[model samples]
Target chain A: MKTENFYISDFCTLRNGKVSKNGEQVYSNLESENIKDFAKGIYKFLELKYPKFHKMDELCKLGFLATEILFQDMEKIDENTALVLSNKASSLDTDRKHQDSINNREDFYPSPAVFVYTLPNIIMGEISIKNKLKSENAFFVSKRFDAEFMTKYSEILLETEKATNVICGWVDLDNDKYDVFLAFLSKKGEKELTKKELNNLYNQ
Target chain B: MAELKEELKEKIIEQLSLEDVEVSEIGDDDPLFGDGLGLDSIDALELIVLLEKDYGIKLKDPKEGKAIFESIKVMADYISKHRTK
Candidate 1:
């Protein structure tokens, strides 16, 4: 077995999931049943001040805020940091918003602000733009969060000399529900990042 | 003209998401674009939509927006004469 000597040095879990890092939960409202409200609660807890965050679609905001939490603690960042995020809806939340704007074309014109986020990758672009990290990025449309696929792909990025670190996760969002879990994978941890570890972290 | 300019300033702030700006700070002669208010091209399009939706004014050409959207006073003067809604 070729060991990549990687580890998920840092991570952030959002939405309704239960996980604790640094003695603080990223989002602690597991029983709220209102995902949108939970996302907002987490954003406020983080006290983010990016004005553009208000303009993003809910899905993009979820992903962006989660990535903000994940990147908050990191001191030094690699230039070739990569992102491999997936979502079951694949921008459907924003797509629906865009559709609503156009559906009422006779009454209201389609808004460019809402229409611009009609792609799933726009979330990644938002993160990339905020961080000024222009690394290799890919947004996957999956039936669900495939831990094995995320684990393997990020490992490949490390082995093939593509990225020094991989930010991988699932940012799934619908009308009032969202599940965003992001992890930073780097080969400089105490232990290697494995499928079992990713599965365990994701299921948390 | 005073009331029209005041209303136009409010509309510009609401339409352009200039949350940090207050109507009192915006002079009637201040440029709406560039470093004056720091509005961009997308804001110009939104202003066009604002005219059509609220005042029933449709600009035939995008270039016409530059002059019309020069300032709150100018926009108010245009809308006062052209407003259908």
Candidate 2:
């Protein structure tokens, strides 16, 4: 399989209850009670534009949205499309809250609420359900982020023809802060994706 | 009684993070659950805690809270009857 073309369809970010464009805050007043709500708010925003979104948890919302953006023009993205996601926190916010519940004498038991969000891959599950994608899915935790890892895994998916298109990004949610960046890589030789391109797109 | 209802409304707003809703928007008889303020099960739990902490009413079952917390008027009435504090 010869891997060649890929492009980004659409991307969104919510910071401090506001959508930022090129580092400028736009569309403020996002109502989110927690980190999950922040993720939900973004999902709700995109769901309006993309009708295919199936309501689910935050991580999946991120994945489904990324997949939607990747395959918006296509009729359907089959199980062959690989999903590669990276995050630093890896549901640490949920873990910390669950730990707090366990430590607290009044609520010493872990609520299923907190435990459900503990896994790093729940986002992928959300994406799979929404897009009906059963292709390869990977979740990695890094001290910062390894671009090489993303490129390498994406290459494997393409080379194997397991996926004609690859959806990859970094999504991290900690406390009140959340950030996400995703891109679609295809084998059609549309645009050459370089380290510089990824850095430039994400760094901003 | 009116004061308690107002306070309850404020507490509901604060607890639920209904940032967009104003006190004026919540009428005394307005439904707190479905279409009125659009609160969900989580908000109901928070309200239960509010009832216990503020009004000295402990509902042994969450199901019992459904009828008692139908609206601000209903909650205030239930609290008046059951409040130990």
Candidate 3:
């Protein structure tokens, strides 16, 4: 069954110490150049209460914050809302920290908390746990944001009844630089979920 | 004992990234897991590493963590009694 009509519903982007939803600037932190501080700023700005947010690595924090911004005004999405996120770095930021912990044999102290987030898919898990989303989830690693792939994959999930809705986009963080563009997709919205539209929103 | 309790609270906060929680907020008898201080199993693992890495106390039995890490006071007592370093 091919489901044709799906809208992009709403979208949010977090990059360069700022957050925007549907091309509108919602939050900005120009004072903090540090990525960790920027993430903490966004968490505080959203007034999020989940303590687990602090435990998340930089990649998960970026994705989690973007998802929170995307779902801020709307009611909770259903459990069938699938998550499809792609990134370039693939948890390299946390991987570096974990590597450093075990790099020296004599000074080794590998933390389980840091070890758990060594995979990029852990970001989706964090989002799912927060929103109670239990549908299909996939984390893809590519050279850059693949808007076309995201659109096609999300469409298949909606058409197959595997997901009533989807929260999909690019969430990549490497070094101190980060880029996130998360969109809420459903049968209702202002813009259609096309490759072109997704690319435009991602670049926007 | 009082000094050890304070140090344990500080170490737990630092090790576990309990950023929002302050050292003063945690009580001496507040349970470390499941609703008291809300520390989870991963934190329990961190406490184990903390015991070994910081205090030079190697736990022979994993079950000892249940009683040893019950609270700030309990952890302090256990560390004081068993710590090698």
State the lDDT of candidate 2 residue by residue for A1-204, as single tens digits: 435544443333444566553344545555667655655565565544432232233554555554554454667666666778888988886688768868967644444434666788888876776677778889999876566777777777777778877777787777656677777676554346556656666676
Q: Is candidate 1 or candidate 3 better by TM-score?
A: 3
Ranked by lDDT from best down, the candidates are: 3, 1, 2
Off by over 4 Å in 3: A1-3
Worst 10 residues of 2 chain A by lDDT: A48-57
The top-ranked prediction according to DockQ is: 3
lDDT value, residue A5 of candidate 1: 73
Candidates' TM-scores? 0.85, 0.60, 0.97
Ranking of all candidate structures by their TM-score, best first? 3, 1, 2
Cα lDDT of model 3 by residue, A17-122, tens digit: 8899999999999899788899999999988898889888988999999988888888667899999999998999999999999999999999999999999999
Per-residue accuracy of model 1 over A1-204 as CA lDDT, tens digit each: 555478987777764444345236745766656655565666677787665665567888788887778777778666688999998999888788778877875787766666778899998888888888878899999898898999888988888888889999899887776777888888776546888888777776
TM-score, chain B, each candidate: 0.94, 0.95, 0.95
Rank list by DockQ: 3, 1, 2
Per-residue lDDT of candidate 3, residues B1-85 (tens digit): 9988988889889899999899999999999998898988888888899999999998898788989989898888888888899
For TM-score, the strongest prediction is 3
Better of 1 and 2 by DockQ: 1
TM-score of chain A of each: 0.88, 0.75, 0.97
